[model samples]
Target chain A: MKIKLSELFFVCVKIGALLLGGGYVIVPLLVSEFSEKRAWLSREEIIDFYAMGQCIPGIIAPNTIMLAGYKLRGKTGAFCALLGLTLAPFVAILLIASFVSLLLKSVVVNDIFWGVNVAVIILIILTVKEVWSVSIIDKLTMLFFLTAFFMCIFGISPAIIILLAVLLGTLRAKFLKGEAK
Target chain B: MTFLLLCFEFAKIGLFSFGGGYATLPFLYHMSEVYGWFSSNELSQMLAVSSITPGPVGLNVATFAGFKTAGILGSFCATMSIMLPSFFFVLLVSKMLKKFKDSPVLNSIMYTLRPVCAAMLAAVAFRLFLESVVKFNNFSDFVFNNVDFKAFLLFVILLIFSLKIKKDPLIYLAFGAIAGILLHFGHLFA
Candidate 1:
């Protein structure tokens, strides 16, 4: 069954437009649209795509859309989906860039933005707490958290940190299990 | 020239900002240091707009940064570069998805990534707090003279409310904007 590029693009555009918050929030919407309504992908398949989204680096929301597009057609579908996912944000940010530049000049706007800054901080702290609750589950994981924290503060590149962490984790899993066996 | 630099820089951001949108902040901060494309002050404003506007927060920041630094083409370059890695991952790794799904090694890595991501976010949160809420020459200055008490109060209230309600973050953003304006004006009047 061949799906048209336009169809894939439009589906992604809809997803991009409606997707707010971040990657995780897109799950239910994607499930309903792709798996339930269009029948383009199965529920299990959507979950697989989401899992892949998390596993991969980059924004998870559009990653899921890209996978659905690939499953629907191929590379062309993938690009189309990526484009569609990007379109809303690209436009929205551009408009915001222009608007914020002007807004920054006004004293009242400055105060408003100051408040917004506080809000952003609150949101970030909440995100840290939320991720912390789930991430800091044991001694080994706690070690990872502390080491990663110090590395970041000292300005070691995050890409390197993530790679090292993944490598250490894989090695520990392999070797520790062998010893146990 | 500039366009390509924009692409390279944002692609770097795209490649590294693991965890999620907020994770991009540290990378963007680095870019601000190296490029002089935008000031740290402007980046704070971009963060505000990114939150208020629709779309993934990281992508929105990338787009805003691109536009500020260059123009329309820069926006395209930045957005595309940031998104390119994800596309590549999907194109390449989708095939391995099924095979790796149940692999213990993969599971371990994912489990390990969770804590690392949390730590990264915590780092960003602390840095941002220092930059926005307290401007001090040193730790003692922060402890004494430099803390922005009004901003700190707003942060505490917003944090408590958000945790209690867990509503759409947009509401808080709106509240912040209004509260900021009122506070600033009230100070003038008093």
Candidate 2:
């Protein structure tokens, strides 16, 4: 079930074309396209990549997609995926940036965005619900979620919170292993 | 020189922007203040455009900002530079994850990180909810008065439809745009 590089690039192009809201929205979209439709990756794998993507620097969507591509093919696949993901947006922004002043002035544009913005909220809410079911399992995980959520709300940098979680998780695993032994 | 500078600056942003796309806002704002490549007003406008456009908002902003700084080539350089760090880093991590797929320590770390990531995303959604669905005139405004009923209504209707139908989000987005236009016309006539 090897996918050609060209096909991979085109599939990614289609995904990139529809990525309207932001990184978080990429989760369900990729799940559907890859896991549901193509059977290339599992739902768990996509979410795992997404979580890892957030841990790394740069935009989450590209990092997740690049990892998916790497899994599907190899380095070339990753490169193609990255290129495809950026292509539409690069051209689009270039086009829009030139005439942005005019577009900004248009009441029609404003109205459309006003509505689209609301739609994006719905999308993000859906993403949170989808991710939550898989992430929060027990009391410890629940504690992790609550602490991270509050820290984020209170304006703590996400990088610090993530680092803390990783350190805490590693130490907890070691303690549990020692207890078992 | 401008292209080189754009590459260096954007690459730094790429390396540092954790969490998600919105996380890049602070860096972009600082860049705006220092470089004056685009005014703060223009940056907000770009953010608005980036939100509704069909792409990752961070990448869109980079493209727009780069173009503003040095035209087409600047945009290319900026985009590539911004993506470069993540590209290499993810590749390295992906390789490591595969190599250490069965390590209990690694598994525990991922298990813990999942909930934290979910929490971070929830936080992002909450902030967006405030920005898009609610509008407050000032600190003292009543909650009911502060909420934008029209947008809130649209959000509720779309949320219900999305939950019930489970269609591609593009369909709902299209429906939202049409509904918005209709609402605008309806207001005009009323």
Q: How many pairs of residues collide in each model?
A: 0, 0
Which one is best on lDDT? Answer: 1
Clashing pairs in 2: none
Model 1 Cα lDDT, one tens digit per residue, A1-181: 7777887788778887877654446778788888788888888888878767767788767777888888888889889988988888778888767777577788888898889888888877777887788778999899999999999877777777877888887997898689889
Candidate 2 off by > 4 Å = A1-61, A64-77, B1-48, B56-58, B61-78, B93-97, B137-146
Candidates 1 onward: DockQ, in order: 0.65, 0.48
TM-score for candidate 1, please give it.
Answer: 0.90
* Regions of model 1 farther than 4 Å from truth: A22-24, A35-37, A42-44, B140-143, B184-189
| Best-performing candidate as measured by DockQ | 1
Chain A TM-scores of each predicted structure, in the order given, are: 0.84, 0.68
Model 1 lDDT per residue over B1-190, tens place: 8988889878877776666678788788778877899988889888888877777788888888888899888888888899998889888876776777787887788788889988888887887788888865346555655688888888889888987888766677788989998998897999
Model 2 TM-score, all chains together = 0.73
